[model samples]
Target chain A: MTAKAAMRKQFTLNPAALEQLFSVLESHDFQIVGPTIRNGTIQYDYIKGCKELPSGWTSEQERASCRLKRRKDDALFGYVPGADSLKRFLHPPELRLFRAERENGVFRILDNPAPAPKLAFVGVRSCELRALSILDRVLAEDRYPDAAYVAARRRIFIVAVNCTEPAPTCFCTSMGGGPEAGGGFDLLLTEIVSDNQHVFVAEAGTSEGSGVLAVLNPGEVTKEIMAALHEAMDRSKAAFKREVATEGLRELLYESFDHPQWDRVAAQCFLCANCTMVCPTCFCVTVEDSTDVPVRRAERWRKWDSCFTQNFSYIHGGSVRLSPKSRYRQWLTHKMAAWVDQFGTFGCVGCGRCITWCPAGIDVTEQIAALRGTAAPAASDGAG
Target chain B: MNSDTGMKPKIAIFKFASCDGCQLSLLELEDSLLDLVNAVEIAYFPEASRRMLKGPYDIGLVEGSITTHHDAERIQRVRRESKTLVTIGACATAGGIQALRNWKDVGEFVRFVYAKPDFISTLKMSTPVAEHVPVDFELRGCPINKLHLVELIGAMLAGRKPNIPTYSVCMECKRRGNVCLAVSASLPCLGPVTQAGCGAICPAYHRACYGCFGPMENPNPTALAGRFEAQGHADRDIMRAFRMFNAWSWQFRQVSEERERR
Candidate 1:
């Protein structure tokens, strides 16, 4: 089926019908992964059915805080992206490159086979989908693409959900990404909750999603369902507490390299590189070789590296960016500006992970506002 | 002598005033300990082996601090005998937690802790190894990371520089994909100023970093301290945060002192 025809077909699925969707994906040898409550935080983990989703739960996010609260209504996929992202699965923290062993005074290198698990990600948000697209461009679209990432990306499927109830830290609307699904999903779902009923309007983006929808045999879409979808989208768009003007932001950051805002932010910034690590689009890696005694056996491994490190820019003499001020400038500019120059797209997806996960409560949006000579609304009043 | 034999480099391990946790880290290299011994001659290590070879060693890994007059003199001699001297762990690099005496009167501390204060022989301050003798390198951590230890040894063997990172614990926490306790739970974390090591263990388990690895290279503790203040953290809380394992390090020392004055 063509993309246009698949998008034209819309259906409504009750809560029970959603369970059948899970069954269909599992039948296709896809390990279903979705958001679930773990250690008092909503984290994406492996789930068997819709029952494991964080139902009747929502989260409050601020500059330096996140808390899950019991909602009066049941809404799956209510919470936004947590610390884990698609980066965790595609670009793993550590991967073995190769192993070498000595045999008869000669060393032989052996390939470490990649583990490509067939995965179907359920409840992916719009900003996260954008992040996945950015990862595709960086890791898969390049000439010397990462073979492991390519192999993993090829076998996976995406089930995206339109975010109706966005967290306070959310600014996807400003980033031109979401609160509503635009594209890059196999299946898209929007939940409509009213006084006595809960229904999901589902749309397919590919043949695989259409096949899954056929098995469930959902009800025909009506004008009521479309109106509900519009309502939810509008409500979420208005709920955003933060706004970052991205138009010409790349140029503003590049021209304002000497702005004192960098030093001001760096003072409170830990240069911990947590922002890059949690950033779905930030991809940097370092390689190291470990060897056994007698130099008989050795293994090469690649682990996630961040630009916040003093050694990240290390050269023959010393690190180019030595101070926290310079390092923070490098990171912010690279994510917001240099990324556009290098990849023809912004590095950030506006998920606000960096704002919500910073131990020091540093907000990137506020810093950008400061760079623009305007004060960002205080985040100290707590979650709205 | 081993150099003439074309064998592994001779290595020595020494301890002064510490819990010996850093030396214990060497033993914790369960997977690579055997390989390490084969790669380098364990000429002198009282914690691991009974065999004690005299100095003039290729590399000497020193643990602990110079908290006594004898330690101050002995480190000088060790520096002369070893071709390369590396300090490992908090005590060797930043005087460890024992450096808390640097702020107080040692006479009172001895009298408070010991029944016979006159019998105790101690220096007024616990000083890092570099204070008494020049060090080739200093490994940062309360009990240094095993991966870094292995890498340093490998680098020494290859006559190259070790590639240990000098970033804060925030980097490690991000790499580990841990939710920030400071932001998520409003907990007072020292991760922003503390060096990355321990694989961000405390934060991974949902606790704040205790600055166990000391300050990162060119850490901006003033900014972190200001943020803590803005978050409504008490003055004592901010002061205590910087007065942890590596409190004697210049950056942490200055920050803690600044908080105390406030």
Candidate 2:
């Protein structure tokens, strides 16, 4: 049970005049945050109005490639999420914890206060919604809570849009998460059969969601319209081109820790640390202290870190996992097998961002399959 | 390494066998360095300070590989004194770019990288820290991330598990929105096999990775090489690609060996 509970409601939206939808949101005293083109990616940001959104934009993504193209029709929420999830907003890359200043003969620590505001996050995708929940588990943990994260998460609204199209790197289905926002959203919008009438079957999941709906003054939605929306969702789920296998992953990885394959993989691994930076779940970090010159004030801060770095495990007079092979094996085992022992869930979300964006184009799904006992000889096993 | 009676974790950073890029990153911590100094007592780091302290330290960071009898002996001694031993850098991990010599006669490499083998003390192959002792954890990357480095220390200090990824580099590139160099430009990339740590730097730099970080969990290098081949990379080029910084990694080794056979 959480501190707050969800409420439910449903309605239909006019897709052709979606700008009116944005205006309606504005009229309700909600600040709109939605997707817009930025630095060659469809990123979410605070928009001045509907014109700031990528109204006529579409993106092309594959296993190691992505590009944006202009669309023929002016549809506001037509594109899939770019590389970032809502985690970027909730848990920022850089955050200030506290400041230490010397006043009189003593050192004083002042916590950085956060400004909480009511926001309406539009175009929320299913995978991103799941990612947000994953973050919720991490930041909102029992023992040690991330105060900064807690501050950013209060009194927010989520507007989840069903995926009408799937990107090549998407594999949320394998993660048992989605192309759909089942429980983590305030409003779920399914765009179904739009030509003369651009319609979205909207459903509310919280009291706050109901409050937002009451402001929209939207027309009634019948059972037939809801059935059509369900059909649209089914079709979108079938459109995913990529998938990840989560069956028996923990048992297989735990049992195969000493399998010779780790050494084989280590042979070609660069140990670059790219996957950690983009992973939605990796939360390792280190603390540092900054000192104010001419004074005795020092403030400690935490920053993100990875296990792939050479100095990550240095202990005593030496390191235990010295080789890339062993280090890599340790990380792999922990993420898939041991993480379940610790977190009671597999760490992977099957987003496939690690595959499509790697400079080397590493495929995690294929590697897991190999570890699960499908490792054949190298396809180019004898070219030297 | 010096513990200084009962103080913070006595940290020691050591290096051997390869270029000092990873060690340099420690010094590169810049503003974070002072805070790090307060977090742990850096008992022995020739690169950071001149004060040498003797060991039986708490945490020891060993970089580079065991390429000689002396190095192997030194690693054993390092393992003996430390409470926890962590390996830093590629040479100490996948044997660095130098492990490529493990595939060939060391004499050939000696003739290539050095002018005088007569004065050099050498071993048949370069190896990572794990080959020597029991390690508590391992940080990947040619030059490990400063942030990840800090996180690992914090985890150890707190006696908590560190959260590092075991996935591939492709995830990072996508996060940064870098166009896929391999698929879009037909560049040979090892993102499929390499561990995730480097922040997708190479792809951001418009160059494919050379796998300096070593292999991630369950890397499928061969399937990826085939993809490269389909993009018009020749068998020779693919082998060359696999033979870079992490070339000696077995997954890559087998892939290139397959290409070498064809």
Best by DockQ: 1
Scored by CA lDDT, what does every candidate get? 0.84, 0.70
DockQ category of candidate 1 = medium
- Candidate 1 lDDT, tens digit per residue, B1-262? 2222467788999898999988998999997888788788899999878999998898899999999998899999889989989999999999999999999999998889998888999899999999898898989988899878888887666544566767788777766767777767777788888888688999888888999999987788987888778778988989999998899999999988999998
All models, RMSD in angstroms: 2.6, 9.3
| Candidate 2 regions with alpha-carbon error over 4 angstroms | A1-9, A16-31, A69-75, A102-105, A116-119, A193-196, A222-224, A292-299, A318-320, A374-384, B1-262
Q: What TM-score would candidate 2 get against the native? A: 0.61
Candidate 2 lDDT by residue in tens digits, B1-262: 2222346778888878868777788788788678778768889989878997999888888888889989889888988877888887667776778887787898777788887877777888877778777777787777777667776776665455565656667655654556556644556777757877787899898888778677876676776777678677899999988887666667777888999999
DockQ per candidate = 0.55, 0.09
Clash count for candidate 1 is 3
Interface CA RMSD, all predictions: 2.6, 8.2
Q: Runs in model 1 with CA error above 4 Å?
A: A1-7, A375-384, B1-5
Q: Which prediction has the highest TM-score against the true structure? A: 1
- State the C-alpha RMSD over the true interface residues for candidate 1, after superposing those residues: 2.6
**DockQ, cand. 2:** 0.09
> Of the true contacts between chains A and B, what fraction does model 1 have?
0.63
